[model samples]
Target: MNVATARLGARALNRALLSRQYLLRRLDLPEREVVEHLVGMHAQIPVGPYIGLWSRLAGYRPDRLSTMVTNRELVRTALMRSTIHLVTPDDCMTLRPLVQQVLDRDLYTNSSHAAVVKGLDLDEVVAAGLALLDEQPRTPADLGRALHERWPDRKPDTLAYAVRNLSALVQIPPRGTWGGTSRTIHASATTWLDRPVDPAPSVETMIRRYLAAFGPASVNDVQAWCGLTKLNEVVGRIRSSLRVYLDDNGKELFDVPEGELPDADAPAPPRYLPEFDNVLLSHANRERIIPDGLSFAEWCRRYGLMMTVRGGVLRGNLLIGGLLNGIWRIDKEKKSYTLVVEPFTKVSKKDLTALEKDGHALLEFAFPKAESRAVQVLPSR
Candidate 1:
């Protein structure tokens, strides 16, 4: 269990994340178990979660995720730093409380009027909203209008945040399931699942799970992933259960005593990560995975979307592997989706052949009507 060979390096970090995040290869574990292990899946785009899971799980049953949502085994809620996350119904019920302070801090820091809602009958509003949602899931707009009408004086945005962040809400099925295109909506966890929601699991339990999946990581990295800063106290309390290591610069990395730390020399493949992959976003010091200067959002803006020189709406496809190796796009024309790969690297004919095969396979699995793909070589600037 000792990560004795762990050196502080990017290759090591990438390989560790691959092994932990289930990205090195697909897994056959239950989807709910995978969701719990990974904390939660990024779900801004309805299909992105599916793409994320498909790339990770060997036995990816799209139907299971959908059914989990329908059955409330899995729930989507505005958790984790005010972004939507696909978490287990049980998890949403428990972790929502632990993250409340963090979510409140984010709201206060990011939004101006969070303090204004402090005096409102938060319990009553949440109760009303919960009662409304308990009967049927309602969209943000619908929930907000209802709450605002009931309160008759509160700001819609602030109320929306209160209801979403303060309550145990779940995004019901067809909103985030495969092949579904719908805006997010909220339902009470108990009502949605047809059972009472469970209580909070300790932060110690959370830290253990996080480190188990993404270990040899600093406490700060864990904080970034969980979006909290007050875990210093908890970290102090859990030292007995953790195994610690010193990085190259003599910084301590903590992990579970029973976790597997891979050899530092294991060969890593060129992994194609879906956007917002937690490995890229979950670390304060991401030098271990992405280079220091790599800003995924910036790269996406520059390469993924086409901007007008004179200023207009951005209208272009997302360019994958921007400035890293190659650029790729998903072309959805004529009711069929096709992946296009344009490698900026000097490709041997053999490499090009391999990329074409790999890219098409990726496309076909991701998009059903992906009839074919196009691969072209672009000169490196």
Candidate 2:
């Protein structure tokens, strides 16, 4: 079969990402299926995935996700870029082994971590960690303190991070629940879930999963998402089984053959994404979701400056017409609630009105207790 390298424009790529991510249209699938389909939700913050699910799935309820955690159908684990994600138990078992190298690289390469763990027996540290955690779940600091008793010379933080990096651990429940606030607690995967991890992990399978969720992407994009390097060989190994495309820069993009490819001009509804949402952070080239005129790197700079200089700076995202056009946040007062939109570019009058309507709907979904609600579109800088 000939692998034709079709060129895709910015909007074409944008629509494809939205469709793949389930942002273009809400699905009627179960919340667990939705979480599994997108690989996992970026959930360093507990409430992030709640809003993420609400934005993508119609009739999403906080209880559904919270129950998943409570019942162990889903888990909060360190995966993909070594961040906390809300992933299925199966993914937790398999994906963790696949990205073990990335976690190891992160642990060994950090100067502080390296200094403390140098010449130490990582296996013993891991064994000790599992032992301590197997006894009962403990916060990272507590784990560190317990491990420090065994290895007093090493920095406690490094010892904790070592356990985090080396072991297949899951963040225990009540920590990842909606509107829940508790100290982060962890336990070995086998102990908590009573499930064994995949003994042999495959990078090729991981690549396929990534394509299914965030596809038509280059090797760099995959690396950017998972922090794994040397994927060119992995992509090459499966190239014959994949469909290929090219970005405007002529770089090759790969996707699963059966994945949906939506029309470039398809209407994209306004979406409210929580902070550190994977749609924004998952790809090396974020142009698929970011608008045409904005520079994502520069946007990061401006966002950082504004977050420091301006109080109440919008940290989450607002997608207008399939383009990530602005930042947004909800402001609640005694009787009134406001959804503030700060656009990075000048939005058309019609789009602004649509945004207001959608923003009010989001406010209702997010904060129904308020007596009044309004969507405020701020002047663009």
Candidate 3:
């Protein structure tokens, strides 16, 4: 297949991603449909997906997602990149089998647990863990202690880690629900979802879905998103069916033929995104959303805030006009809620006004019954 010689600049690429992500405008779709469309959402942080969906969907409610969890319509599991994601039951079954190798690789190479589990019979350990989980969903510590009784020589947590890597376990509900305070609990996906892992999961189908949601992307981008390697061959097999383009850096990008590329000057409203949103983390190259030559630490420094290691990783990013501009967080005190924003660069009064307006709306959505709410945009140093 001949690759299209068209080139997409950063702004164009950013808009395409925003359009596909439903970030360009809030959609009035069903929550399950949106979840399935994005494939799944990054859900390492429990409230992250709720905030994410709230930003993308019109009239989104926290309880709707919580209800999905309770109904087993959606589950939180370790899938892409071996991090917990909120995905549909069908996707959990289909995608887990494809990424099993990534999980296994982590199991063996992980410095924390590898040595202790190196010579142990992993299959036996997995069976034991499953048996325990079958009886009831368990926390890692509880499961670990139970398995430790069977394998007295190894650390209990390592045995549990083996099961975590080898088996498809879903973090059960109330655990991932919005405002949920439950301890993390796990149960076997097969039993919990009442369905077997897809015996024949399709990497090509997965690739196609990636393109539909986040494409005009390179082979490296796909690997970065899914944590799978050597997909050049699979991409090669399906190249003829895809539309291709060159990014400004001359990297090859592939997309479904019908994928929309909005005008580079498209208007993008300011959005508040939760930490670990896939839109920020999915691509090998993030310059499309994160502006080039903008140092996040320096940006925070200019705003009189010291960026900590944890702060660096767990940031709620602010987007304006299709690019990252600031970081934000909601603070609670007594019966009040505050949305605090720190911009990376000095902004116009107009942008600040827009940000403040959206910030108040977000606060209302996140903490509806707070006695009071406020939006604070810290000044640049």
The local lDDT score (0 to 100) that residue 255 gets in candidate 3 is: 96
What's the residue-level lDDT of 272 in candidate 3?
86
Writing each residue's lDDT as its tens digit, candidate 3 over 26-126 gives: 99999999999998999988888888999999888899999889899999999998899999999999999999989988888999988998789888999
Q: All candidates: CA RMSD in angstroms?
A: 4.3, 2.2, 2.6
List the pairs of residues colliding in candidate 3.
Answer: none
Q: Candidate 1's error at 372, in angstroms?
A: 3.8
| Candidate closer to the true structure by TM-score (higher is better), 2 or 3 | 3
**Candidate 1 pairs with clashing backbones:** 27-58
Error of 2 at 278 (Å): 1.0
Q: Which digits, one per residue and each the tens of the lDDT, describe model 2 over residues 1-381?
A: 437568987788888889988998888889988888888999887888988998898777788889889999999999999898999999999999988988998899898898788899999999999999999999999999999998998888899999999989999878998666767999998888898999987889889988998888999999999999988988998999999988898888999999788899888887878766888877888888765434455566766644212433223777877876778887767868888888777788887887787787777777677799888889976
A best-first ranking of the candidates according to their TM-score comes to 3, 2, 1
Which candidate achieves the best TM-score against the true structure? 3
What is candidate 1's lDDT per residue for 59-125, written digit by digit as tens? 4646777777777677777666567788876677777777777777765565556666867877887
- Residue 111's lDDT within candidate 1 is 56
In candidate 2, the residue pairs with backbone N, CA or C atoms under 3 Å apart (3 or more residues apart, or in different chains) clash, namely none
